[model samples]
Target: MGTTSDQTAQHEGSKAAMGGLIVCPVDLDRPGLRVLDSGTGDGYWLQDLLGTYPRLVDGTLVGTDVTAAKFPKHGAPQPISLQIQSITQPWPSEWKHSFDLVHQRLVLGACGSFPHATAVRNLAELVKPGGWIQLIEPDQTCGIQDGPAMRDFIKLVTWVFERMGGHARYAYDVKRWLLDAGVVDVEERSVPNYLGARVPDADLARRTARWTADAMMPLLKYTEGHDGPIPIPREDLQTLVPRLHEELLERGGFYPLRVIYGRVPLAKE
Candidate 1:
């Protein structure tokens, strides 16, 4: 009972999605770049990056999410363009090997089961010779551990996502896929989510509770397609929120977030 593509796009992995955006600010410095992207919900990364480096006016960009989004706000010598597309489908044949960079970030189940190899192959095929491709995913191990809220939160979400037949653990070993795809000069970086990081970050914790509720709703109602036992109740979602809130504040508070990414030139020099 997860959200439709529209609603689910909002919370790309907490830190995993954000980490994908952490691509080298250096990529923006190169001239005349063309970037093909995957499932960019808000397009904040491109909006902020083009603004960060006005010289990138010579660059071109296109983004694809399952659904459309308002064009991002940016200031640059050239306008940034976005394209919305389905993750499960084949490439739009005309655009093969066309982009200077291909990036898929925190798409989890959307990238396909072998997200590591399959997604990497997709990105590699889109990049022009000498161009590059990058993949960013999280290994939520850092964010998980034995604890009250932490343990409960993990169990609930994992159970819900896994049951849905979707990826709840794209974080682990995403780069291995990149390497297998023959990407060269590959590199990786890991960063923490800083849960409830500061006052501003507290909202992250709240939102997660909301998702847990949404994830569970589908599981409970869909079993046996109208004949199975009610595994969970609507009230259960409400009950967890307050409990999750309190757990985030306890000492040694949860920090369940980490991102790893890899990048490589599309062609050998």
Candidate 2:
């Protein structure tokens, strides 16, 4: 887990690159519409969506996570409710086939605790027939021009996540998961999250790099339960932070973010 500041920085970086609250086209005016944001960190994405489509105020909007301490107070015209729930477990029976739009972003790290297929199937079960599901995750396999330190960092982190029963590179498989879960018309859009100081938007890139470095700090200290500590030392991680930034500054250095979405098939389908 990362600090609040680190998460905020990551959100800002993602928002700058992704261009909106979400990439999927939602019909805010649909009757009895309901929206659910699984792993809704700080509720920013849901807030942005509600802010953009004020008409959704009439519908139910819920954000669920393992904790509600970080959810923002909702004074928006439509109330955004926060629920404390874990994505790995089965959702409430009432929630099954209940939402018009289900959104989850950057939850791969947490979802890695369970089988990817099971986690995704649980999310898919929350959508109503013909509703939409949108998932966004970083393609861990696709970092650009990684330096030796960054390379080592990736290797270490990947190993740590796998040891914890999670998949670090799950983003690359999201579309297939949705499809296997019976979603239709699946669509995928990949965006380059430019990092490093040489990109056109260098300020955002720098902040993103810093956030990435900060987020990885915990993994540096992580140890598999019976195995000794992860090989990377704290000092090495500290040194790698600046080195990562420097690497990103080189030409064509960026991370790829993939947004994959699909619609729940209508019953007749």
lDDT of 2 at 7: 56
What lDDT, from 0 to 1, does candidate 1 have?
A: 0.53
Model 2, which residues run further than 4 Å from truth?
A: 1-6, 29-32, 73-78, 142-144, 224-235, 245-253
Listed in order, each prediction's TM-score against the native is 0.69, 0.84
Candidate 2, overall lDDT?
0.75
For candidate 1, the TM-score is: 0.69
Which 10 consecutive residues of model 1 have the lowest summed lDDT? 1-10
Compared with the true structure, all predictions reach lDDT values of 0.53, 0.75
Q: Residue 256 of candidate 2: its Cα lDDT?
A: 69
Residue 6 error, candidate 1, Å:
16
